[model samples]
Every structure is written in structure tokens, then in C-alpha cells.
Target: MNILEIKNLSLAFSVGGRYYEALHNVNLSLKQGEMLAIVGESGCGKTITAMSVLKLLSPNAQITSGNILYKGENILEYSETKMRKIRGKEIALIPQDPLTSLNPLYTIGSQIEEVIKEHQEIEGKQARIIAKEVLDEVQIADSEKRLNSYPHELSGGMRQRVIIAMAIACKSNIIICDEATTALDVTVQAQITELLKEIQRTRNTAFIFISHDFGLVHKTADKTAVMYAGRVIEYANTKELFKNPKHPYTKALINALPDFNSKKLEAIEGQPPSIKEEFNGCSFEPRCTFRKDICKVKVPPCIKSENSDVLCWLYN
Candidate 1:
């Protein structure tokens, strides 16, 4: 089943008396036990898209148009009370920073127990038992001992594990991971990714993994979406997208990857445009190497391929 569906979603934030769109016509879907990665440079609307799905956008931000459906219901129509139930119970989010997400005053066990107690009918002792099991599942050494330890007492990796434990405590159907491993070392990042994959296998949890690291996405995601200037320029299966990127933006991203076989790395030129208003032309045209006159004058519809889709005049 499709756990989440986003169709033509756009988000804008009012800044200095003007509204700037952060995400434009973004469409994405997630199936059970599947992982999809949204990758782009900073301020490319990667995190904005995730935040919109969780309805945690900033006070100045608002959804202009489109629908965000979760479990076949339109979540955009949900009230604050209804959205609260969906936030941690049905749709869980593992934020990038563990220190910021965890409470310094609370022990790991207490934190996890609180989550379980909120949704499940389990009481104090039972919640603690469930918390320990989840902590052990994430491969935290000495789960019992670590449970009583506060977030500040644990190492970076252990703290991340605790965050993951709390996220999965309610067995949410969908997990939105926004740069979840950015603060960890490479080795620890790999371990966390592996743990997430294992959890997905065992529980059939769907994942929307957001990251700036293309290499990490290659290891974790089944499909990849390339975002540019608040819009998705290309999307495809991970292997297919890496092997053959049709859009100029997607091509540049792949070429920029540091490879052992290649000495020089090709970088994309120019900056993403400010979205104070919608642009009639392609947003990526300014930075795209293969941009033509048509690309500068008109927006291109997403052209379908056998294994992918690209929004570029070059494809037309």
C-alpha cells in the first residue's frame, strides 16, 4: 500500500513582506517497506519537503496548493488535534541532531517510555520493557544500563541510536529521516543506515530519507529524487538514475561525485534562484550546462522514461 502521497505540493514562507516559495509542484509517494531519498544542495527544498509532510513548517510557511495524503486520507485537511495523533504515532520523524531532539533532563528509558505510553495501552513497567527491546534492536551496547543514562552522558552514535529507538517505539508506518546521520562519523552512519534497513525489513516501515550525501543515498534508497530550486528535476530507481541521468541538473550532480577513477570533479555553476514568485521558465536552466533557448522561456513537463522521468527541454 502507498503509505504516503504528495501531489503537486508547494510551500511558501513570508520573509520581509514577501512570500518565497520553498517547494514547487513537488510530487512523491512511498510504499510499505520502501525507502526514497530526496537529494540536493542546501536550501534546495529537501528539508522543506520533509517538514511539510510532517506539518511542522515554520509559522511563516504555508501550503499554497496540493494534497498530502497519508494512509489514503488527506492530511492537509487534518486539524491540529488530528495532526498531533499522526505526527508521532503514524508518521515518525528522526531529526538530524540527536542533542536537540532529546531532552537533557530525561533518561533514555524515560523518554522512550513516554512515547509508548502516549499511544499504546501499556503502563510503566511494560513501556520500559518495550523501550529496552527497541534499544537492543538498534545495537546499543548494554541496553539496560544505557536506558537509565541521559542523552548528554552517551556518545554521538549512542545518542543517535536512542533517537531512533524513540522514533520506532510506536511502530509508525512512515518514517521521515531528515539528514538523520549527518552528525555522525562515516562508520557510525553506515551502521545506522543498516539498522534502519533491518527495521524496515522486520516491520515493513516506509522511509522518506532526506540527505545531501548522494553516496549515502545510493546505499539506502530504492529510488532517488533530484531537487533543484524548490522543484524536482529528475526521479528514477537508484541504479537507473546513477547509470543514466537525463536532466542536466541530475547529470551535473552525478558528475560532481568524487570517484577514485576520476581525477577532476565537475561542479554545477550558478546559484538557485529566489522563489519570490513562480517562474515561467525552468528553474534549473540558469545553472544547467545543456540549457537551450526554450529552457529559458518555458517550463518543461516531466517526460516519462522506461525507468525514470526528467523535466527538461533537452528531453523534448
Candidate 2:
């Protein structure tokens, strides 16, 4: 069943009395026990899109139009009080940087306990017990000892596990991981991804996994959304996307990955366009290898391809 849904969600940021669109008609959904990965280069509005669900956006940011439906209700219309109730208990965020996301001043136990107390309303002795249990659940060895340890004292991977433990402590129905494993090495990244997949399977938790790593997304995500200049250019099942990418951007991204057989690397030419620039046409027109005259004159509507839903004239 669809647990979270984002439909035609458009957003913009107010900068110096000007509004620049950041997310354009964005749409996404997360099912119970499924990991839906949003993959794109930096500044493509990946993190902001997830933050919109929590209503944790900057004051200057504006949601021009859309409905962020959570379990069939439009959460975009939810008041701050109602959002607070669901923010951590039902939807928790595992932030990108473990190094900076946690407070160095507090012990891991205290931090986890605070979340449990606030969202779950279980404090003191009960919260501490649940905190330790969640730590063990995330496979952090010697959970009791680590509880007293400060964030600075633990390894990157262990700290990340603690963050996951926080969500587990709340028994969150949906977890939004925004580049949660970016700082870790390949081995640790793989481990964290596996841990998340395991959590999804065992807890039946839904996840919105945001990352720029295509390789990791293939390994971790069941479905993938490829964003470009704040739009989802391509979306498909992870397997189908890897096997047959319909969108030009998706194809370029997959081709850019390291291939032992090809022993070659291909870089997507040109940087992504600035959101500040108004786009009557497709934002990717400047960078796209197959840019057509029509691509430069009007934005392409999302077309249904055999393997994926794509926003490009090639599939039109």
C-alpha cells in the first residue's frame, strides 16, 4: 500500500524579493517495506524534496502548489502541531552527515532518549531501555557501553547506526535517509545500505533513500527516481532502470559508471542549470546530447515509456 505520496508538488525559494522554483511538479510515492531512491547530482532539490514532507524547509521557501499526502491525507495542509506529532514517530529523518548531524555535547544515550521521550512520550527509565534495545537492533555492538559514549568517541559507521537506532526507538513507519552514508567508505556504505534493507524487510518500514551514487542506488533501491534541475527526469524499477534506461539523462548516468568491460569513463557534459534561471523549455536542454529545437522551446511532459516514465522528447 502507498504510505506516502507527493503529487504535483511545486516549490520555490524567495531570494532577494525574487522567487526561483526549486521543485517543479515533483511527484513520488513510498510503499510499505520498499526503498524508493531519489538519485541526482548535488543541488538537484533531492534533500529539499524530502524536507518538504517534514515541513522542515527554510522560511523563505514556498510551496507553490501540490499535495504531500501521507496515508491518504494531505500533509502539506497539516498545521505545525499535527506535523510535530508525525515528524519523528511516523516519519523520521536520518540526516546526511553523521559527523555533524549529532551533538558532540551529548552522549549517544541522552540523544536517543530525547527523541523517544519527545515523539514516543516514553521518558526516563523506559526511554533508556528502548534506546539501548534499538542500538542493538541496528547492530551496534556493546550497546550499553556506547550509550554513554559521546558522538565524537564513535566511528562514522557506529554513529550512523546510532541515528538509525533513533528512528527504530521511535518505531517510525517511514524513514527519510538523505545521503546518510555519504561520508563513509565503500565498505561502510555497503554495510549501512544492507542494514537499511534489512530494517525495511524486518520492520516493514518505508524509506526515501536520497543519494547521488547510482551504484549504491542499484544495490539498495527497489525503485529509482532520477532528478535533474529539480525535476524527476526518469523513474523506474531499479532493475529495469539499470537494464534499460529510457531517458537520455538516465542513460548518460549509467554510462558514466565504472565499467570493467569497457575500461572507460564517460562524463555528462555541462553543469546542471541554475534554478534562478527561468525555464520555458526543459532545464536539461543545454546539457542534453540529443537536444532538439522543441526541447529548447517547451518543457516536455512526462511520457510513459516501456521501461520507465521519462521527461524528454525522445520518448514523446
Candidate 3:
């Protein structure tokens, strides 16, 4: 069963004198108990898509057109109360920054307990017990003592684990991890990924992981979506995306990753298009090595590939 579906979704924000489109006609689906990674550079709308899923966009941003369906229900139609009920119980978020997400005034245990009590009917003591159990589940040593520690007292990895515990407090069906491991070191990143994989396997929770590195996506994502200039240029199964990247942009990104034996690394040239104006042609055409006349003059429709869908004139 599919947990979420987004069709023809476009998002825009009004700033200064003009409207900037951040996401354009994105179409994707998430199956239950699977990990889907949306990969792109900093300004490529990956974060925008994640915010849309959580309904946490700023007041200046609006959904231009399309539907976001969670379990066959339109999430856009939900009232604030209904959405509040679903936020932590049905769908939870592990935001990009653990430090900011934690409450500075409260202890880690108190915060986690508060989340459980708010979403579930439990006493303070019971909630605390559950919090401790979950903290241990995430591999936090000295769970009982760690509960008393403040956000500033714990290390970065420990704080991140606490955040994860809170996210899974009520056993949410879906979890949105937006650059969840971007702040950690290499060893910590590996540990966190393994912990998340174990949790997903045990609880059957679907994950929407947003990241900029293709190598990390390969480690965690079952399916991959490549975003560029507020649009998805390619999407496919993880193995297929690595084996046969159809779009020129996708090819460049995959080739840019450094190989262990090779001393040289190929980098993609040119910056992403500015969000100041809407473009008629492909946004990636200028940087693409395989640019053609049609690519520069008009945008291409998403074409069906052998194993996935790609938006590029080369396939057309």
C-alpha cells in the first residue's frame, strides 16, 4: 500500500515584487515501509518538498496547484486541528537541526515525555518510563541518567538520538528525515543510518529522506528522485538510477562522486539557475554537456524510460 502520493504539485513564494516557484509539477509516491530519497543541491527544492509534506511552509509560500494525498486522503483539505492530530501520531519529522529542535529550557526526558503525553493518553510517570525505554532503544547509554541531562549536556550524536526517540514516540506510520545526518561525523553518520534502518525494519515505517549526496542516498534509499531548479529531472529505483541515469543532469551528479582509487574528481560546472524568474527552456540546459537547440528553446516533458521516468530532451 502507498502511504503518500503527490501529483502535479507546485509550490511558490511571494517575495519582494515577484513570485518565486520553488517546486514545479512534482509527481511521486511513497510505498509503505520503504525509504525514498530526494537528492539535489542546496537550492534545488528538496527542503521545500519536505516542508510541504509536513505542512510547515511559511506564510509567504502557497501551494499553487496539485494534490498531496496521505493514505488516499487529501492533506491540503485538513483543518489545523486535524492536521495537528496527524503531525506526530501519523507522521513525524526529524528536522535538519537537532540543536534547534530540542527545547533548551527542558531536559531531554521531559521533552520526550511531553510529546508522548500530548499524542497519547499517558501519565507523567508512564510517559517518562516510555521515554526512557525509547532512548535505550536508540542505543543511548545510561538511559536513566541521560534522561535528566539537558540539551546542552549531551553530545551531538546523543542529542540526535533523543530527537529520533521523540519522532518515533507514538510509532508514526511515516517519518520525514530532512538532512537528518548532515551534521554528524562519518562514524556517527554510519551509526545513525544503521539505527534508522533497524527501526524501519522493525516498525515498518516509511521514510522520506532528503539529502544532497548520491552516495548517502545509495546507502539508504530504495527509490531516488533527482531534483534540479525546483523540478524533478529523474526518478528510478536505487540500482537503476546508478546503473543508467537517463538525464544529463543526473549523469553529471552521479559522475561527480569521487572514487576511492581515483585521485581526480569531476565536478559539475555552473551554478543553478536563480529563482528570480521563470524559465521557458530546461533549467539545466546551460550546464549540461549534451545541450541541444531544442533544449535551450523549450522544456521537455517527462519521458518514460526502461526502468524509470526522466525529464530531458535527450530521451524525447
- lDDT of each residue in 195-302, candidate 3, tens digit only: 888888998889998889788888888999999999999999988898888888888887887742154666899899867756789999889899899987898999
The prediction achieving the highest lDDT against the true structure is: 2
lDDT against the true structure, per candidate, is: 0.87, 0.91, 0.88
Q: Which 10 consecutive positions of candidate 2 have the poorest summed lDDT?
A: 257-266
lDDT by residue (tens digit), candidate 1, 34-136: 9999999888899889988889888999899999988888999999999999888888888898888889999999999999999889999999999999999
lDDT for model 3: 0.88
Q: Write the per-residue lDDT of candidate 2 for residues 187-232, one digit (tens) a residue.
A: 9988999999999999999999999999889889999999999999
TM-score-based ranking = 3, 1, 2
| Clash total of candidate 2 | 0
Cα deviation of 289 in candidate 3 (Å)?
0.5
Model 1 misplaced stretches (Cα beyond 4 Å): 260-263
- After superposition, candidate 3 runs with Cα above 4 Å error: 260-264
RMSD (CA, Å), each prediction: 1.4, 1.5, 1.4
